[model samples]
Target chain A: MTAAEERAVIDRVRRGETEAFEALVLDNQKKVYNLALKMTGNENDALDISQEVFIKAYTGLHNFRAESRFSVWLYRMTYNICVDFIRKKQRTPVSSLTYTDDDGEYMDLEIPDTRYEPAVEAEKRELREALSRGIDELPQHHREIIVMREMTGMSYEEIATTLGISEGTVKSRLSRARQNLVSLLNSYGTFSKSGRHKTGKEVEGHG
Target chain B: MADCKKYMDMISCYADGELPEQEQKLLLAHLDGCASCRALLSAYRSIAEAAEETLVQVPDGFAAGVMEKIRKLPRRRSGGWKAVRPVIISFAAAAACLALVFTVSPQRFDFGRNKAKMSARVEAPDMADTAERGTDSVLMDSAVPEAGSGEFGGTEAAKSDEESLFLYEAAGASADVETPQTGMATATDSPAPNGAATDGQPVDSTSQVTRHPGVKLGIAGVDENTLVIYYAVFTFEGALPDHVTGVEKTDRGGGLYSLVVTADVARELINEGYTNYVIGNEDAETALVYYTED
Candidate 1:
């Protein structure tokens, strides 16, 4: 539906119509689910977070102002809920004392290349998996910007507004997040250890 | 290679298609000679592409599950001002409140970590609505004597307390007020609530609010017409009982809180020896719920 039609449906739902909300749930569920998955790195957690995002959106619809798109609003809720979950998860018994300290500096640790294989397909798999793992392991600030910008496709302006930071900060932080992810991927041997040999040509075929 | 370090942030913005034309050109020039940066940009693209393809199949009947949960939620229904005219409230403890406000007197307001300043606020969109709809509120009818006319029954103690007091648009809205003294009646506008309309004076919303909880927060009312009053500056002598929602450090900092209360919450606090510590009137403005464990 067009944005206008979506807003009209929201108004209808606000006035007590059930069907309008049901349709909204179906329309936006996939993006919401995927955004959650990117941030949490687990499908089960993503599904749970998706349901909560919609529930919060429905109950707090009155507080929503119309200046931004509903999707941005939905994504803001998704990011905040995901951050809460990550923080809670970090606080819980992490199951391994040797992993990292309170700062969760496991991202800075080096991992052996036990998972790496020489095959091209295996290399690609290793890269994607390492990327996901690296994203999960980054500091909270880095992970947040990467998830918002790279995973959710938010513009710098949208991100700055949602996060209440300057566009300059967004640019610098996103740069720093990418830099950290690259280093994390390198540590996991996702890059060829011998001179870091993967070239621009290899990645060009991805698009 | 170190020069490439400076382009790192620009590289990120470029990857997101956010770099300005001039900077993009500069970065392009740099990337031509730097094979590593090219690979990095390509890797960035690959990551973006992979993320786009990372869709998990949503479980069946997800929307149905959401709808079912939504159906169970209790919907809140409130009418606009025109329909709901019973939005005014009167404090039954106005006279008793006036008498005891002076008892606590004033201590140096260090606003210490161990001290929890309690306050409450009454919310109305505007006084114009209250003036138009408060007819059903007989308590409101008796309160609000003529504004700016010398009808105040305040004492020397009340006027002296007004120096630290500032008028607030709403009762208890200010958390940092060391003295909770305020009023709206009589010769001064210090009595916060009951004095808004004594001789049917139309409360001009444009009037500066200088409400203090110390003078007389009598008949504090709101559009709910739920009454709102705020008084904070509590000093608790002991640990809060379990029934008391334990010493939570609010987001602002430790040992400071402002709660908007209803008659029910006030009554609950009253049952817990709250009267000995502070004024525990049901529907109180919470003139001063300053709690601190010694």
Candidate 2:
């Protein structure tokens, strides 16, 4: 949502127009849901966490300090809820924890855009599956930081403020998180020789 | 160098555009020339894109689910004493119930837990007051107490009050730095008994260890395994400015000492070239007193 539009919604919500919150829910639902899906690596858990996030947002709206943008705050809430879920799951590991990446191995990007081609779609599906597995394997802190940084495009200071941390810590954690993800992906053998291993190296280098 | 740690540290900030623009440009230029770096950057972008793809999709009826919960929450009556009455009544009832519980089953309340709780309650008020001062020093004298012993159990409330006294005294150190008339606990050369005064207190427990030769400052409410500290105070050549606070006094004890500063000031000091102190005893300081990054 545009800044102006978000502000308008916030103004309405602040004035007891609780219905206006639906506008927010509808607009950011996709991104929020996507974040959940990535973090949980399961559609059902993702959906559950996304709904839980919105619910949490609604109840905790009173605590929202208007110093930063609402979406930034909302994303932080979403990230935290997901983390809690992951932590709880870690304590009581479930059968789903060991689920294999069913999607095929190859990321065949060389194929041209052929209409109605099953092969290309299959490759895409496999790539997505591999990506999900790689992400799921990342340490919780690093994964969430990456999701917030890359997916939401929040600045370091903004993320820091949202997470109640120093920007230096955020930067440091983010660097570590990315480096960890690169190693995880490399270990999984998901990347082809074509600039695949180097990507992680470069990220590690820069981080 | 094949293993350049500094360059590795820049990637995360670089990805977030946190580096200076010129530094970012330089990094990008280096990436353009460095095949290994280019591949890694591309891989990072891909991974980020993949992460973006993985966001949780909220199910339908999410708003309804939330609205339902909101509806169940007890609403405050509109305006004035009518609205405030329920809160007061609930609080009174809660207090009565707690009193009855303790009276009926006095043994139910573990003395140590009760003491800790009491101290916690007392310290909260002092924390609020210190927080208002902005530069107030926070002194937390946390004791795990030996296993199967309750020496401090009955004195929890009084000791908590003492903790507040120490906090108020520590805040005084800040008073000279910023505001004046913080509290009256004059500075002294000898370290007080740990049980007597927070600053000059005498050490009663042989096990009570001194960390870094002074008190430390840090935030509470972090997991033990993942203790993350954002602040630490070390030596200074001259006396602390009248407006500055140190957690401990320097040799000669000339200036008002404040062991800890707010996280904001701590960050600034770090950026301006402060050092992280490495202490010997981990068990000596409470989790709140020591800071670390997990």
Candidate 3:
């Protein structure tokens, strides 16, 4: 949604119109959910966090200063909520803290059968799983900044505002996150010149 | 002198197409003379492109979940400006009583341990210690008949005194002034449903009691019109509280808590424009009522 449209919706929402909020939710939910999923490396937690963030935005709307755009404010709240959850999890030291599928797994998208063979489906799933692991393995700070930059397409200034850090910090963090991601994706398999991962260059045979 | 760090950092910026012409020329000149810097720039450009490609496309139905959570929140009860008529009267009555209490005998209730315990309650990792707060302070003052009495050492009074001290610590938090930066409010000194005020004096309106004993308060009253308040209460693994049902949390970092409240509340807030706030009082200790209009 355009910034003006968002502002109008937010204005309507503040006036007690329930439907107006759906625009705000519909507009940014995907980005918010994707960021959570990437950061927590789990789907269920991401969904939960995304929902919680909107609820928080609704209640804290009173504190929403006009210095920043509504989207930036919302994103800032999202980052804070995610970090708070992680902090809570850390406070309780437990043995064998395996990343549960519910912890960071994305909701399994229902892929309609295009008459693809079972083996093709399996390969696709495996690729997704590999990508998920690679993203999950990044350091917490790096993973978060990368998600903000790449998934949300937020500028460095916006990211810094959301994360309560300097623009320089945002740039540094994004650079590091990208470098880490490159190394991770490369290790999973070689990337051909076309950017797709090549399981085996010879067998794929593009000469 | 060491070479300019800004000039060096410009290589990464230039690859991003973010460098000014002068800086870009300086970087290219440096790269021409320095193979290491050239390689570094190339590596950064590649990484930037890869990062751009690495973003995972967000899946569908994410908004539905966020909206769902916002729907579950409790609505705010706006009493309008005329509503303050009774509240102001009550505040006046309470102030008069306070003056009478002070004039009769100016007894300083030194909430020594009470203050410490209150701080701990507010900052404790969990809200478990909150219950022990009010019950302990009042018991301590009355039980200790004398400051250094040995007769009550092993008696029930001693036990009650210990409990009261615990409550006192939680109640006597540092006084908060009515400042713009932090508009803090506390509960008025009315009796709880089942217990008396632990401290002999009225529990000052400086420490607000949280609703749902173990719940920690988060942002309250989205705006003047929205009725629902949000709390970072309890552990909801992979989900928010049933009321805050719809949101999906993202990683924005820092010790921040965020949630989406329902559209109705959002609209109400927008219209009201944040003109009023109703902090927790004795009967309703946890909730704060804020309004935009009269």
Candidate 4:
């Protein structure tokens, strides 16, 4: 929906029209859930966080202020809720940890469809798993910035505003995060040196 | 050629298309002559591509699940007596007592010392230890009425104390304060500096005294409207709390510390064994609790 339509929906939700919130939930849930998935690396935890974010947004609808885009505000809430969830998970003992049933619901979009040949599918799965592992290894702040920039595609301005940091800090931090990811992928032997060279040539030719 | 190291750092920004026109042009020119830089740029691009291509799909009915949960949440009531219940109760109780006293003895209502004693009788339990600690003396210095300023009946003294108490209650009710700036008091032994008051009011040390079981404590001079209280428990001496919830701390120069927490978190921290002192009324803009342990 356009920004104006989203604002109208929000206005209705704030005016005691509870069902109007569903439009917002539908519009933003994918990005919000994906962000949680990327940040937490656990599908159940992502779902839990995503649900919690929408619930919080519904309750906090009156505080929306409409100063920034609704999506930016919602993303900020998602980021903070994920951070808190991570902190809570760290505090909880492993014995008390519980996992939700897989239920075949959460899917990794990067996984190739059945149409792909088995060998290509396996390689794609390996590459995707390696990238996930690489992302998981990053420190929380770096992971957050990477997800915000890379996964969510937020501009530096939106990220800086969400994180309450300078755009300069965002740039430097994002650079550091990417470098760390590259080093990790390299260490895992996911990308060969020659492969990188070939990729460079292809990109340069395109440029 | 542009220095490889300098341009290498800019490659990520260039890859993201964040660099200014001149810097992008410079980096592009450098890349043409530099093989290693080109490889680095390519690696950065690859990483970016990999990151972008990485997408996680939500479970089916994800939005529906969220909507279901939201529907289960109890609906919040619109403003009414329910919204202002606490304020009404406090004001009604205070007024009722005043009315009872006036009906019993009209002459007694005009006595400043009697009024002071009555207010003290109502306020003393909360401030008793603070008075004994001499913090009240420091606080009174800032707020005590001049000799001829109608000490008990003076609007200034009454208003300031009432406002101070009101700010405190308001803070306790709402735990929403801006992040407080750390002040420069580092030594545990040194007195809090002059500007440490959260609201820029002279810290009324007497107004915020809390008597814990064995310790007589004061929040020194925090303004509730601008600061929230954080409950910090250091496992060892000088260690920070392991899990801080909504609140964040500001180092007030010495061993003294100030915390800012949301009103909800502040309420949770209260009675959780942290030294609790409040400053601000119901109308106060922020809820701030200044906590420290002896």
Among these predictions, the greatest TM-score belongs to 4
> Which tens-of-lDDT digit does each residue in B1-294 have in candidate 2?
242244544655665556878778767777665555555555565566555655445667876665565444333234111111101011111122222223334453333423453334323333322222221111122111122122222223433332332322232133222111111122344332232333322222211111111111221211112222222323322333232333422122223222433333433322222222211122222111122111
Q: After superposition, which runs of candidate 1 have C-alpha atoms over 4 Å from their true positions?
A: A37-46, A85-126, A193-207, B76-294
Per-candidate clashes, comma-separated: 42, 37, 69, 22
DockQ of all candidate complexes: 0.18, 0.21, 0.11, 0.17
Candidate 1 per-residue C-alpha lDDT over A86-178 given as tens digits, one digit per residue, 9 for 90 to 100 = 654763321121222222222222212323342476666666677777777775566667877876778898787656567888887777667
TM-score of chain A of each: 0.68, 0.66, 0.70, 0.72
Where model 2 places Cα greater than 4 Å from the true spot, the runs are: A33-52, A82-125, A162-165, A194-207, B1-6, B77-294
Query: What's model 1's interface RMSD, roughly to a tenth of an angstrom?
Result: 12.1
Give lDDT tens digits, candidate 2, residues A1-207: 888888777667655666677888887787777777666667877777666666545544544555667777667656655654665476322222221111212121111111211236565565567666665665455555677787777788767754556677777777666655555554455554443222122221211
- Candidate 3 interface RMSD (Å): 13.0
Tens-digit lDDT string for candidate 3 (B136-171): 221112221122221211123333443332221222
Report the C-alpha displacement of residue A78, candidate 4, in angstroms.
2.0
List model 3 lDDT by residue over A46-142, tens digit each. Answer: 7777776666566555456565677666666667656656764662212121221211221111111222222455554544554556556766766
TM-score of each: 0.53, 0.50, 0.48, 0.55
TM-score of chain A of 3: 0.70
What value of lDDT does candidate 2 attain over all alpha carbons? Answer: 0.43
| Candidate 3 residue-wise lDDT at A87 | 62
Task: Sort the predicted structures by lDDT, highest score first.
Answer: 1, 4, 2, 3
Please tell me how candidate 4 rates in CAPRI terms. incorrect
* Second chain TM-score, each model: 0.33, 0.32, 0.30, 0.36
* Model 2 vs. true fold: TM: 0.50
Q: What Cα-based lDDT does every candidate model obtain?
A: 0.49, 0.43, 0.41, 0.48
* Interface RMSD list for the candidates: 12.1, 10.5, 13.0, 10.9
